[model samples]
Target: MDQKTNEEMLMFVEKATAGDKEALETVLLSAQDLVFNLSLRMLGTFADAEDAAQDILLKIMTHLSSFQKQSAFSTWVFRIAVNHLKNYKKHMFAQRPLSFEFYGTDIENGKSGEVPDLTQDVEKSLLAEELKLSCTNVMLQCLDAESRCVFVLGTMFKLDSRIAGEILDMTPEAYRQRLSRVRKKMADFLKIYCGEYGGGKCRCEDRVNYAIQSHRLNPKQLDYTEAGEIPLQTMLEVKKAMEETDDFAQNFAFCKPYEAPERTKRFVREFLDSPQLSVIRNAEGRG
Candidate 1:
């Protein structure tokens, strides 16, 4: 199902809110992949994404009683995730923010010296793929948080404008307008700097050595390249829009679904067995 049907969602909320631990676990786990993937794209690294995702999930569970069943549970979860990520201040990219201009300049002038031989453990092509994924993921950091959210929801996630607008508290028209502006801004940047997607000379293979030397990407510990994939259909329930422009789909196609780390489930299990949660449950009359 693209989205949870209303009856199924209400059943989950009722069971979860009434202290059904198994149902609650099911609800939280259902949201984990969507929240983590969004966090990954917004925060620009696996570790930061996982950290932010854990926080967001906690917020969702604690606030479960406040859900009024007015929207799809997935939509409610997404709303919370987006709000948390936009306001999160401790992520690496937030600490050292990037702009398109600065990133483009780095792309043009960043490479130095000889390309290293990274064919020790894995093929050069694998390292190149790692660098390419790293580079594109980092590029989203160039957009401000709000614009990045707009691009991610509108383009990468292919969310319906109406639902996306509701999540961001914007009118559909306004969301679409912002999405259009950011799309052009990003497309222009890619056209000028990305060789694979545009006319620029900067190739992922050409920058692999510099990326590794700068510690931007680690060949020994490739977080994204080593992660498991969740097929597009198994990801968030995005309602495809007919108006979504086709110009940059290929450019951002690297925004595929990556599975959340297995520790998230363990974290949830720990919370369920904690005294802190016991206090919360008793206070909320959920036990």
Candidate 2:
């Protein structure tokens, strides 16, 4: 997310803190996509991400008045997001262990059945993109939640260590060490399993059949990517640009950043209309 200027943020914050509906709406709109993507990458599922995004937004709204302007508004928002995700990770782990062992085991066992023939070239291309995303998603689960957050913010989102540290409430040195560990872990795994890193037995083409057979990848009902909505040339252009990055974790860059879903917009609208905000408004007015 781009940093908002101090003056612009202060204007929004003042109005929002004073219970200005439009200013509150604008604040939510500005940060919604960034928060959603952060949740998506942290939680590793759309359903969880959506839930987390809504929760984070409400938290932000509820506490808008308490925002101190010592830091960028984006930084404060991300701090809330990172803290929520860390807590969510704990709750998620208590429910079930998240791991990539199953994916690796499936690949080693060669669970791929007969490959299906999808007639359309577009379907084939989209399926390949989906498989690549699926692979990267699994790879992300290998790291613990905090490490994953650091890696995502640093490598994928291109935030510097100092900024990322502020978001995670760690020292820049600590963030760099964590990111380095994650990078090495991801690099080692990619070299062994990812065909993109060369000399890997597992290929997207090989896994596409397995994904299809397992009902994980449905050509008729593509669910993983928004490739269908995006122009082919545009998608290709984005991929080409990502390929040009001078990074060892190039495969990490291939997975598209999560876009906020329609439901999130509805959630934000409903939140704005709810009686909860009225109480805040009354309180602010009395003050």
Candidate 3:
């Protein structure tokens, strides 16, 4: 989704805050992708991401009146999302074993059984991408929730330290420090496991068959990420797009961008069509 200008965002915020149901729907709808992506990356499961996205959207609507506008509307929305995910992670106890451990266990226990020979180059390439996304998604769970959030916001979403700090309610210095720590930890892991960072043995191509045998990669149903969409670049500036260079850690974190599932869009539309619409409109009439 394209970034909105301050003027454009303020207009939406004004209308939404005044309880205009259409404006409220537009504002939330524009942010659906952002919320869903963040939730999927943070939660590491489609079911959890969908649930979190729905809950976060509801929170955004319920708390729309409390948005003080001290920061950009996007930043405020992100603040809610980041905090919500952090809490949700705690509630869900999402800190599972790293992908490497899980894959190793599965392979050792003969859980994957026999590998199927995929002769088609097109099929191989697609599976390779899917494996990369699956591996990266699980690897992200290795970090603590705070570190994961910091790494994602700084590397994948490419938010600057100040804006990212505001989203997490931290000082820029603190955010940078946390991001540095997370970067170092992730870089170390990538250097050891990712072939792109080094000659790591755990190449995505090598894992495709294992992932398939283990039912992690279903050719018919590609989950976790979308096909043909470009990953979000390391864009720091709000208005200007920057060239993305190969930083070992950043590259690993950004291998796959989260794609909002169709279900999420449908949920938002249904929400806008619900009785909540009456509540927002009635609030507007009262105001």
lDDT scores of the candidates, listed in order: 0.81, 0.70, 0.69
* TM-score of each candidate structure, all chains considered together: 0.93, 0.82, 0.82
| Model 2 ranges with Cα > 4 A deviation | 1-6, 89-96, 114-122, 218-221, 227-247, 280-287
Pick by lDDT: which candidate is best?
1
The TM-score-based order of candidates, best leading, equals 1, 2, 3
Tens digit of per-residue lDDT, candidate 2, span 1-287 = 32455467679879988768888887887677778777877776666788899999988987887798887677788889898997785334326555556656766786554556642455666688777776676567667888889877776666667777888889988888888777777777777767855346888766776677775566665446762232222211111111212356654665456557889988888888989879867776676
Predicted candidate 3 versus true structure: per-residue lDDT over 1-287, tens digit per residue: 33566567668878987767778777777777778778877877666788899899888887787888787777888889999998785433364445546544543454233667642344777778777776677677777778889878877777877788878889988888888777777777666657745445566676676776665677666674453343453111255322232355435644455556778878888988888778865775676
lDDT of 1 by residue, 133-220 (tens): 8788899999888999998887767888888899999999888889888888877887889887777878887777788777887878
Evaluated against the true structure, the overall lDDT of model 1 is: 0.81
Worst 10 residues of 3 by lDDT: 234-243
Residue 207's lDDT within candidate 2 is 71
lDDT order of candidates, top first: 1, 2, 3
